[model samples]
Target: MEFMLDLAVSVVSLLVVGFYTWSLRGHFYSPKMATGAKLISAVVIATTLFFLYLAWYEHQVAWVQIVGLVIEICAAALFWWAVSASRKARLRFAFDPDHPDSIVTTGPYRYLRHPFYTSYLMFWSGWAIASSSTWAVVPVIAFVIIYVSAALGEEKKFSKSPLAPEYEAYRRKTGFLIPRFDQR
Candidate 1:
């Protein structure tokens, strides 16, 4: 049972990496942006592979395995939804906040200011939970910090841009990384 669950987690991790890579096609980036983007992508890929490596030896409890799979799937769905919604927005990598010409407020963006980051958090948290190791949380923490930094950087760019007013309004209606039901 442990091995089977581990194998499943490994498969899911690979799919997540594949999906993310597929989503990046055709997006142009400047040299600086490309370097940052590559670093980000490398970190993500390494983290996902680390999860697979942990699965090879660490045995996860059945409940954690099941729950992790559920969270990963949900995160994947959210990612797809966000990507689909921003299909026409010409969304750039989060590393390049200044590259986006417009703010996306459709689909998942309508509710979450950073749905992509939220989904990433969910995915990483799910994997950490599945690993059933205390050390697994290190990567999760690192990713949380990274995502928050990226989101804040983007927010700073937005505040400095002409879209500040519109983004402020949108921010009021959306949550930073979670759904904000109590809109003012």
Candidate 2:
């Protein structure tokens, strides 16, 4: 039972990542970060990969792993939904200096301003937990910082876009990495 669950987790994660990565490459991505946030991103990616490899698959499926997997699945679903919704809205997935193709408010974007980063964090959390290594959380913390920085960077860029005013309003209502219910 645990083995099957493990396999399911691994396969689902790979498929979602592979599909998203491919889809994202089709758009014009910003070659730069809004404010040098790119520096930490490199460390984040390298550490994440190192920790993920350290958390080898086939570890005992403990409660923590199961919880992490559940979060990962849900985050992946949200990520997929947001991406599809954005594409449907013709919102190009780039971060160029120019204005964004559109300001997305549908799907996950309505709740979290950066669902992709949120999804990555959730996925990383799951993999780290499943590894059953207490030390895995260290890299995971770095992962969170990196994504949060990237999300903030996006907001900074958005602030300069044609949708600056609208984006500001949206930011008030949306959380950076998670859904915020403080606003109606």
Candidate 3:
């Protein structure tokens, strides 16, 4: 019964992610959005949720739970920051993937090349650690690989734009997912 409930939760989470991604498809990368990528994300989320359920059932230590909570909070903050930055950039400046517009240098983009993906990774990593189950780690690893691949692909596509040179310089200075506090 517990397994079934967990599975349901996993499915629901995947559906939510899928819907969100679908809604943002055209605004970001390839207007069509890759079906394969979406499917992969769904599988990864499902797997992670399953492992999370197992971990929850096992009952980890209090300290681990607290650490997990902190990580999750950080992840949420990062995600929110990324979204806000994106919105500001969209409003203040124009970005047309089809037309190849200017690169986004403000907001979170000023620090991390891929703030959204970074936040997502942090969230998943925290979830895996919180679960502290070997099974949970599997999905986290898979999610990292998938996200990295997608980011690389997006970068390649974005490189064709006129702002490619500027973006390249930004990429050289900033970390892929994590922001460097010491560097201005």
Candidate 4:
């Protein structure tokens, strides 16, 4: 059962990466941004591979792995939803410095201003928790900083755009990473 859970964790991690990559199809990014994105993607994939190694060779508690698996599943679903919703919006690479052409408020975007970053953090946090080692936290913290910086950069761009008024309204209704339950 434990082995099965570990395998599932790895499988889901890979599937999420595929989903993310598919979402980038046909989107043009600057050379520098593309390079940065590829580097970040490689690092994230390497981290998942490391977790897979630990799961298969090292001892991890079954229940903790189960919890992490559940979180991973949630992250995957959220990411898919965000991707689907933003498909028409032409998603941009992180730290692109380009103004958004549209404001997406449907699907996961309705609840979170940065659903992609939220899902990314959830996946990283899930894998770290699944590892069931205090050392796993180092990567999680690093990812948190990276995603937060990207999200803040995007937010700053939005604030400076002509859509600032519209974005400000959406920002108030949506949470940064968590959903605002009282946002009616």
lDDT of 2 by residue, 6-37 (tens): 56656665665565566545532555444444
Query: Considering lDDT, which of the candidate structures 2 and 4 is the better prediction for this target?
Result: 4
Please give me the total number of clashing residue pairs in predicted model 1: 0
C-alpha lDDT of candidate 1 relative to the true structure: 0.82
Q: For candidate 4, list the clashing residue pairs, or say none.
A: none
lDDT of 3 by residue, 1-184 (tens): 4444344433434443453354354234444435655566576557655755665477555566556556756776776666666653431111223433546666777788777778667766776666656667777788788778767765776687677777788778887877865454
| Cα distance off (Å), candidate 1, residue 76 | 0.2
Instruction: State the C-alpha lDDT per candidate.
Output: 0.82, 0.66, 0.60, 0.81
Off by over 4 Å in 2: 26-59, 88-101
Best first by lDDT, ranked = 1, 4, 2, 3
- Of 1 and 2, which scores higher on TM-score? 1
lDDT of 1 by residue, 1-184 (tens): 8878888888897897687777777433333455657777888978877887888876678898889888998999998888888777776776774635789988988889988889989988888888887888988998888889888888888888889999999988889999886666
The TM-score-based order of candidates, best leading, equals: 1, 4, 2, 3
Instruction: Compute the lDDT of residue 177 as modeled in candidate 3.
Output: 76
Error of 1 at 82 (Å): 0.2
Segments in model 4 whose C-alpha atoms lie over 4 Å from true places: 26-36
Q: Give TM per candidate.
A: 0.91, 0.76, 0.74, 0.91
